[model samples]
Target: MAVTTETAETGLVVRYSFLWPREHDRGEREGRKDRPVCLVVPVNVAPGAVVVFPITTQDPLPGRIAVAVPETERRRLKLPGDRPCWIMLDEANGDVMPGSFHLVPFETHPLRYAYGRFSPAFMRVVLRTMAEAIRARQLRMVQRER
Candidate 1:
């Protein structure tokens, strides 16, 4: 899929990721993270149809959302004044904080990119790998302290 996540929009990217209707995470485990977050959004496209994504931006407490539908999918989601539904991002990674993201729809957003599928199982594995990376990073600090 080779999704090139922007350096500036990382936190918001995570925000997009959390938008799904809850298959994981606990009550207290949902909204905490290490830093700023990026949102990951999922669009429902009919088979053989392109999924149009509206890129949006938000803050940690996640109050405001500015969405710009992708120019490519603009015509798709925008059918006779019937634009796509609006959704807010959910916070998942408590260790990593979410950032304020400026979302532009896949059609209009200049930085638009494409790909396929987010495997929650794969994400979970990657998370475990991330935990190891964190531990290794901490080990260096421990050695310095020693």
Candidate 2:
């Protein structure tokens, strides 16, 4: 499907080059590699802007905020093999969609624009936890230009 702003909804999992906040802090302007990221705020929320939280198979280090992906959710995506994955809630990468340089189609499936979407109930849990992280001043943002 076409990855237009209208189709990029919250909970949608897309492969993206996510620039980490620490990387940005260190003067890096690009992400190291493409990885799965959940769309937390779609472009419609702030015209042209989208916020994506990173997904990783690695466990969260101490003091970091993250939410584990339930088995059902994992089954839905069929991702990360048998290893548990976590959606990092402590930070997000903000970029403009539809025209984002970092948002790319899967190399293995050029026509596909996304993996799948999280269930609405699970999405609510993600958003709520993210909001808490934001309120606690634990959330960091790396705004990507172009």
Candidate 3:
């Protein structure tokens, strides 16, 4: 199901079809295709549109923008089997549906699919990391244009 007024708020975590590229060969290996993502963009900013960062349990790769999910926060959110998760900040994916944001459905306890929302503090850190990554990317782009 898509995101509604109740679930469109920032800091909400939802599962969606995320096309993650492989580390070695982006087009070859399949990364976490479907996973949870944190909504970073406020609902007011873009009512229907949303900006989200993908979450993964794999260790942060070199040169890839990512934010480590602290143990305390992970426990609070009840992530998958206490495994460490990281939020990728290099890019932001969106899920817009009929002039509204959409979020994939998920089950609790067993966590068959999507989990749920995350803590405000964790979202804050994610936003900060995203900002830094955007700046870095912009800088690199500017340099390339020179």
Candidate 4:
């Protein structure tokens, strides 16, 4: 279960939200549009917390997708200070051109997959390949730093 702090308004951070994955509502289903849907909630970035990066549905992005909060524009949005809104930041990859989100942000969680998505075996292979790629890039970055 996901835990969200009680906040009057949810601050938008990099086009993502804090209270996310709100249950589906077909009757309330919206027509095709471009926007990320989520609720408002409080976020606590405690010390010693290892931030977990959420994956995106879109692949071959310019960078890795990580959950981040708003630091600069929280006050302007009239949200509860700096809420922990989800954000996609490129680590090794840089400068992903912005695009429209038809619905919610394509988070990597599989529950919301299409009726027939990629097979399990394929998923394993893809994950392995990604792991290797990340390792190689990290090593290259270390070498460059040295």
Tens-digit lDDT track for model 3 on 1-146? 34565556677666665544333234532224557777655446545456667778988768888888888877766666668889887755554533321244554333233355677777778777777887787211100000
Show the lowest summed lDDT stretch of 10 residues, model 2: 40-49
* lDDT accuracy of residue 7 in candidate 1: 29
Candidate of highest TM-score: 2
Tell me the TM-score of model 1.
0.23
Expressed as tens digits, the lDDT of each residue in 1-146 for candidate 4 is 11222211222122222111221122222223332322212136432121111223333345443333233322333323333443332221111112212213335552231111223443344345445545655211100000
lDDT of each: 0.27, 0.85, 0.59, 0.27
Ten contiguous residues with the weakest lDDT in model 4? 137-146
**Model 2, CA-based lDDT:** 0.85
> lDDT score, residue 141, model 3?
12
Query: Residue-pair clashes per candidate, as listed?
Result: 38, 0, 4, 1
TM-score of each: 0.23, 0.92, 0.69, 0.22
Error of 3 at 144 (Å): 27
Candidate 3 residue 65 C-alpha distance from true site, Å: 1.3
- On lDDT, the candidate that comes out on top is 2
Whole-model lDDT, model 1? 0.27
User: Residue 8 in model 4: shift from native, Å?
Assistant: 26
